[model samples]
Target: MKQLIIITFFLMSSVVLVAQPTFDLGIKAGINNSKVTFRASEYNSESIVKAHFGAFGRLGWGRIYVQPEAYFSSKGGEVFEEGTPSERAGRFDYNNIDIPVLLGVKVINGGMANVRVMAGPVFSVMTSNKIDGNDLLNKQYYEDNYFGYQYGIGVDVSNFFIDARMEHGGELYKHPTLDIDGKNQTFMITVGFKIL
Candidate 1:
């Protein structure tokens, strides 16, 4: 990933001979239907309020382009522990901040709209380690410090954009048979702006 970013930077410096780098800023918000699972573990699904509101920029030279974005996002995972009649089950919630950089290839373009495919790594940090009035359950999970990878496509029409992508922690946990291997898979949609 470092190599890819470096190469892209050099390419952008040279590509500006025709058209200089251009940028756009916007805000995005959406719902996250998340699941913490594995090939072995039990199913734990959570739907929390997930959204991103920040600034994004695009650098383009004719049809070939690259977009880099930095944003603050409230991301979390939830699981239902146990339940009974007239009693609600416990919940697991984690809130985080996500920073993503995307590299894209434009397949088609129009005067008022454009379509591109993107893939990149998201660097995330845990901002809140406690959830649902409990601090013990969320500690070890929050200690994980690593970059997750995401890939998706985008459709930009005038000032509106829609994105769909998948993300994973890429590691297994210590819970063994109940270990959560597939962690933090987020499906999101947010409205953005083209503040050129």
Candidate 2:
């Protein structure tokens, strides 16, 4: 009976070791070009370049994985008058804390490199805002919290990884007395190194 128990224990340990899941945690920083679009056609919007820094973690079982990330992002856009090239209308600038939970799949799983695709929902909370050239627009016009979606592709080479993604945010601003509303669209690229 003692010999039988010892053999069973070794078998279980081997199974557990062979089926271990993969996990990695890392820090990342990236740049983004962001813009705000209005529902009204009379207002024209332009993109702005900004920076973001964050930490991310990934857990994987075979080719499927979940990644959760939190980052501080600076985003905004400038408004222009329709049909006017040089006339500056106004600008909206804000900082946000963004959190995204992504589901991803490895399309090409190689020994040293991999290609992946991912999509997920993101939640953002405004930390600060600045409205320029317009007295009618203030901090009150913007929502404190909002939701968005992100989709992207990524490549991993050894311990280094890179990702390119697009984000579309829900309604960010709505005027109290006017029919003006705005949302955010952004393109971002990031590079990171895995610590574990």
Q: CA lDDT, every prediction? A: 0.61, 0.90
Model 2 Cα displacement at 32 (Å)? 0.7
Error of 2 at 113 (Å): 0.6
Model 1, 36-66: lDDT tens per residue? 4434433444556556666677776666666
> Which regions of candidate 2 deviate over 4 angstroms?
1-19
**57-156: candidate 2 lDDT, tens digit per residue:** 9998778899999999999998876776644567789999999999999999995899999999999999999988755356688999999999999999
Distance from true location, Cα of 20 in model 1, Å: 3.9
Show model 1 residue runs off by greater than 4 Å.
Answer: 1-19, 38-40, 80-89, 133-140, 170-182
Q: For every candidate structure, what is the RMSD over all alpha carbons to the true structure, in angstroms? A: 7.6, 5.0
What would the TM-scores of all predictions be?
A: 0.71, 0.87
Candidate 1 minimal-lDDT segment of 10 residues: 81-90
TM-score for candidate 1, please give it. Answer: 0.71
Clashing pairs in 2: none
